[model samples]
Target: MSMREINFDGIVGPSHNYAGLSPGNLAATRNAGHVSHPRAAALQGLEKMRANLRLGLAQGVFLPQPRPDHAWLDRLHQRYDTASPHLKAQALSASPMWAANAATVSPAADTADGKCHLTVANLMTMPHRSHEWPDTLRQLRLAFASGAFAVHGPVPAPFGDEGAANHMRFAAEHGRAGVEVFVYGERGGPFPARQHREASEAVARAHRLDPARTLFVQQAEVAIAAGAFHNDVVAVANERVLFAHELAFEHRDAFYADLRRLMPEVEIVEVPDARVSLADAVSSYLFNAQLATLPDGGMALILPGEARANERVWTWLQELVAGNGPIRRLEVVDVRESMANGGGPACLRLRVVADPATVDPRFLVDEAKLDRIAEIVTAHWPEAIEPGAIGDPALIAQVEQARAELLRALDLVELLDS
Candidate 1:
C-alpha cells in the first residue's frame, strides 16, 4: 500500500496535426493550418517520459486513440472522402493526446469508498473534443482495472467537464487525505468557458469526495479571454504547494482563505501580473508545468522550453529557485511541437496518486520500454503532416499502422479493438 503519484502521458499520435480546432487556445489558433511533425512530436514526448523516469518518478503512458474514427464518421453520415473540411478535421483530431483533459481523479485517500475514482471528461464545449470520452474511458478502465480503483464514465453533456486540467489537490503527502480543488468557469468574452460549475459538482459527488474537503473555485473570466482556456493554463498544484498566476481565480482571496482553512500547511506561490502578464503566461505556458514532488522529498517544476525563453517568466522562476522556495529544481523540456498545439508539460499528462502495484503493468514503463516505443515512432510515424494530408488515404493508412505497431510492441493489442 505504498502510494505515489504516477503521471500517465498520452503518446502523441501519428495523426498529430494543427487544424486550429480549439478556439480559446491561442497557440493552436495562431499556428493553425501549419505543417506538423508527428514523428518528432512523439519522440519529444517519449524523451520527456524518459527524463521523468530518470528523476526517480514512476511514469506511465496512454496509447494514441484510433484516428479517422470511421465509426464516428459513419454516425455523422459522412465518409472521410466526401466529408466537409470541418467534419474531416473533427474525425481525425489528435486532441486526446492532452491527457489532462482525459479525466478527473480522486485518490483513495479522499474518496468515501477508499478507491481511487476517475470520471472521464465529457469535453462538450468543443466539437473537436466532444467525442473523446468513449476512447478515454476504454483506456482508463484497462489501466486502472485493479480493485483499488474505480473508473466512471463522463459527466452528462450540456455540463462540460475538462478533467484534471481544471482540478488540483493539496496534501501533506501523496498517501494522506487531501483537499481537492475543482476550478470551473462561468463566462469567457469570446471563447467558451470549457469546464462548467455543474460538471465539477457532478464529478465531486460521483467520486464520493467529502464535501468538507472539496472546494469549488471559479476560473477568472479575464484569464480565459486572454487564452487561459483551462485552469492549468494559469495554475498547477503539487502536494502542498500551489504554483499559479495571480489572475488564475475569480475570487482569489476568498479561495485562498477557504483552502487555508481546509489545509493549514498549504503554500500559495502566486506570480503577480506585473512580473508576468496573463498573456505572457498563456503564450509561454509558464504555469502549464508539471509541479512534481521529488523522491528525495524536494519539489521540481518540469517546464516546457517556452517558459525558459520568456524573459519575465524565466527571471521570476530563477529568482524563486535561487531563494529558499519549496520548488527547488527547474527542468526545462523541449515539447515545442506540443506547445505549438496548445499543450505544455502539464497539459500532456494526467496525475494519478495511487500505489504503482495497483495499476496495470502494461500501462507503466521503464527506460527500456520507452526506448522500444521510440523505435516504433521513428520507424512508423509520419515525418510531416500537412493540414490537407489528414484525409489522404496514404496518410490514414500510415497513421493506423503506426498505432497498431505501438500496440503490438507494448502487448496492449486489446486496445486496438477498443
Candidate 2:
C-alpha cells in the first residue's frame, strides 16, 4: 500500500496559554477572568481539537495520534551543514530541543495502510495576526518541510495593514504547490476598502502565481459580500465559526438561498446551529470521524473550519450515511485552538498528499452504541493515581507506570482492536 498524506489538524498543547503563565506586560492582571486572554481561548481550542482527534481515534476513522509541531522534523529539514558556526550551533541546539521539547513526530501506533494519514498545526498562531511572516515562514519551512506535508502559508491578516497582501506575495514566491491561502473579512477590523479583484491582482503581481487559482473567501464579515463570487464553499462567515453559535435562522436560510442562486450547480454545504461547546465541537469534528471521500474520488470537503460549522461537510457525511451516494471514508482532523486566538481544525493541518495508506479499516460506530463504548473507555480511569501531587522525579516515574496501567486497561476495551 502507498503511504497517503493524512490531513488532520494536530492537537496543540496550551503552549502560548497552556505552556505557562507569561512574565511580560501582556500577562493577565490579578483576578483576571483567565490566566491569559488569548491563551485561555487557545487552551480551550486545543481541548476541542484534542477531543476531535480522540473521537477519530475511537471511531477507527483516524490514524493513531498525529505528528507534533515541534523539533524532530526541524533537524531533518534544516541545512546546518551550510550554516555559519553560530547558525550551525543554533541549529544543533534547536534540533535537539525540537525533538525534546517540540511535539511533532509521526504516530508510533499508526500502521501503514493505503489510507493512513495525519496532520497538525500550531495553536493560536496566525502570521497575519502577528505580522511576523517571512521570519515565521523561514522557521516553519525549516521545521516542517519534510514528511511530505501540505503546508498552508501562515495567515497574518488579523493584523492591520497589508498583511494579507504580504502573505500572498510570500506564498506566491516560495510556497509549494499545495499551499492554501484563506482570507477573512474583518476580525481585527473592517475589510480593507480595496475590492477582492484589486487584492487578488496585487498578490498575483507580488507572488508571480496566477491569481485566478488562488483560494479566496470573505471570512468574518457582518454581511456576506461573497454571495456574488461563484467560488468554492460559503460557510457561516461569523466571528466564531463553530457550532456553539449558528447562523441566524433567517440569515442561514438566506445564505443558502443566495448560494443556490449564485452557483446552482456548485456543491454547497451549510453549517448548522448546533449549540455544542467548543470542546465538544473540536472532539466530534476532528477526532471522532473519518474524512468522507466524495463519489468522484476527489476530496471536496477539505475545509479550514469546524466540521459542524461547515454545512457542506455535515451534508456530505449525511448523504453517505443516508445512502444518497457512493462514498469513501477520509479522516477529519480538527486543529483550531478556539475562537479567541484564531483558526479551526483546517487552519492547523495542511495536507501534503492524499494517502490512501492512512485510512483505518476499523472505522465504524453506531451512534446508539456510542454510550456503551464511552462507558467502557471511562472505566479505565482509576481514581488511585495523581501525578500532580507527586515529586517531579516520582511524577515522571508514575507517568511511566501509569502508561503501562492504561495499556493493560485497553485490554478490556473491545472498541480498540488489538
Deviation from native of the Cα of residue 23 in model 2, angstroms: 22
lDDT tens readout by residue for model 1, 140-243: 99999999999999889799999999999999998999999999998888999999999999999999999999999999999999999999999999989999
Candidate 2 backbone clash number: 49
Best by lDDT: 1
Model 1 misplaced regions, further than 4 Å: none
Q: Relative to the unseen true structure, what is the C-alpha lDDT of residue 119 in candidate 2, on a scale of 0 to 100?
A: 21
Pull out the clashing pairs in model 1.
none
Per-residue CA lDDT of model 2 for 20-104, tens digit only, reads: 1111101111211222222233233334334433433222111111112214325446443343433322221101101101112
- Going through the candidates in the order shown, the clash numbers are 0, 49
Candidate 2 regions exceeding 4 Å error are 1-14, 18-32, 35-135, 143-208, 211-217, 223-266, 271-343, 354-418
Provide the TM-score for each candidate, comma-separated.
0.99, 0.35
Q: How high is the lDDT of residue 385 in model 1?
A: 95
Error of 2 at 80 (Å): 30
